[model samples]
Target: MTGTLVLAGTPIGDPSDAPPRLAAELTAADIVAAEDTRRLRRLTQALGVAPGGRVVSYFEGNEAARTPELAEALAGGARVVLVTDAGMPSVSDPGYRLVAAAVQHGVRVTAVPGPSAVLTALAVSGLPVDRFCFEGFLPRKPGERRGRLREAAEERRTLVYFEAPHRLEATLTAMAEVFGAEREAAVCRELTKTYEQVRRGPLAELAEWAAEGVRGEITVVVRGAEPPAAGEADAAELARRVAEREAAGQARKEAIAEVARGAGVPKREAFDAVVAAKNAGPRG
Candidate 1:
């Protein structure tokens, strides 16, 4: 019989938040795969639980290469516990590949629920959490980042992202450019840790603030695009929105769909609007 694979959530900031089952699983596993073996040691020490299993490093650098090995251990009926530096595994962290491999190997997979930076930031963001999406990290390059933001410009669901401190200002600037300066957002820094700060304001204001240099694990929550009021989104407006998206690097088809969604109109209506605009355009 295939062994079980446990994906445990570690503390993001306060070690005391570690789930009660996490310590027990860590102690009982036959093999422990940790994103950072050193951090794992510190965590275990804090919890006062010595692993009865062998611990191995399984970070982004080695995750692809190490997943197969861990899968084999699971196949051999060795109960494996996977933990990242913080939060849940496979959540913008290093556990997805291993979990996929375990499933392929017919191993039973389970999770130890704990704190999540994504959910935590969203809860405190003051933005609508009824519907939200986690965007993880954005591209490092300016153009790529802008393009990604543009793609989500018309999204009506609140968006969440993890960003580096050094790049926060630039990211906020890009968000303001793509999603509008007045779009509301919250920059959650060092969540659940001492000096935890949640700076809430418009994207442009947040960008200006981040310019002064901020630090810590950052989570950004941006309010979604507001839909136009009933009878407010005219054909010209829909066409204009689509054109803006196209200028920002989105394909015409996707741009139309996005604009339609934001305007609460049918894709066919948006497409017709675009067609009419093109037909009425000035000829060279």
Candidate 2:
């Protein structure tokens, strides 16, 4: 029989936020795979739970090489508990590779629910959380980052992202450029910590504020694109709308449907508009 693989969530800021089950699991595990062994020690010290099992480092530097070893332990009926420095494992963290290995080995996997910077920031962001998407960390390269942002420019669902403090301004400026300067957003910094701050305003304003230098862990929540106003949309306008959605990675069919809905026009009318635009030669 295969042993279980537990993905535990650690406190993002306050150690008291650690789940009740976390301490028990840490104490009971056959082995603990931690993103940072030093931090794990601190966490265990805080919780007053000494692991009955061996603890090993499982971070980006060694995750690839360590996954197979951990999988073997699970296959050998070892109850392995995985924890990151903060938040749940495999969420823009370092547990994905191990989890994938465990699943492939037919090991049972479960999670210990706890605090999350993503959900926490979203909750305090004052943005619509009814429908939201987490984009994790964006590419560091300016060109690549902008390309990624452009792909989500037409998304109607609220977007969330994790960014480094030093790059917050650049990211926000890029957002202002791609999503429009007036786009509403919230910059959540040092969340759940004593210095926790949520600055809400237009993307341009946030960018300007960040220009003065910001610090600590950051999560950004941006409002989705507002639907075009209902009106009699001309062929050119409909075509332009469809093009924008397509440029942002939406399929033509879905884009046409959305454009029609926003314009309060028939889907067929939107289709016709797109066709008309195609038939007309490119604008000189």
Best by lDDT: 1
Model 1 lDDT tens row, 1-284: 88999999999999999989999999999999999999999999999999989999999999999889999999999999999988999999999899899988889999899999999999999999999999999999998898789878988899999999999999999898778889999999999999999999999999999999998999999998887878879889898888877776778998888788777789999999999999999999
Candidate 2 pairs with clashing backbones: none
What is the per-residue lDDT of model 2 for residues 1-284, given as tens digits with 9 covering 90 to 100? 99999999999999999989999999999999999999999999999999889999999999999999999999999999999999999999999999899999999999999999999999999999999999999999997898788777768889999999999999999898778789999999988889999999999999999999999999999999776655537888899888876765567997788778767789999999999999896777
lDDT at 273, model 2: 94
TM-score of 2: 0.86
- Where model 1 places Cα greater than 4 Å from the true spot, the runs are 246-254, 264-268, 271-284
Per-model TM-score on C-alpha atoms: 0.92, 0.86
In candidate 2, which residue ranges exceed 4 Å CA deviation? 236-284
**CA-only RMSD, every prediction:** 2.3, 4.0
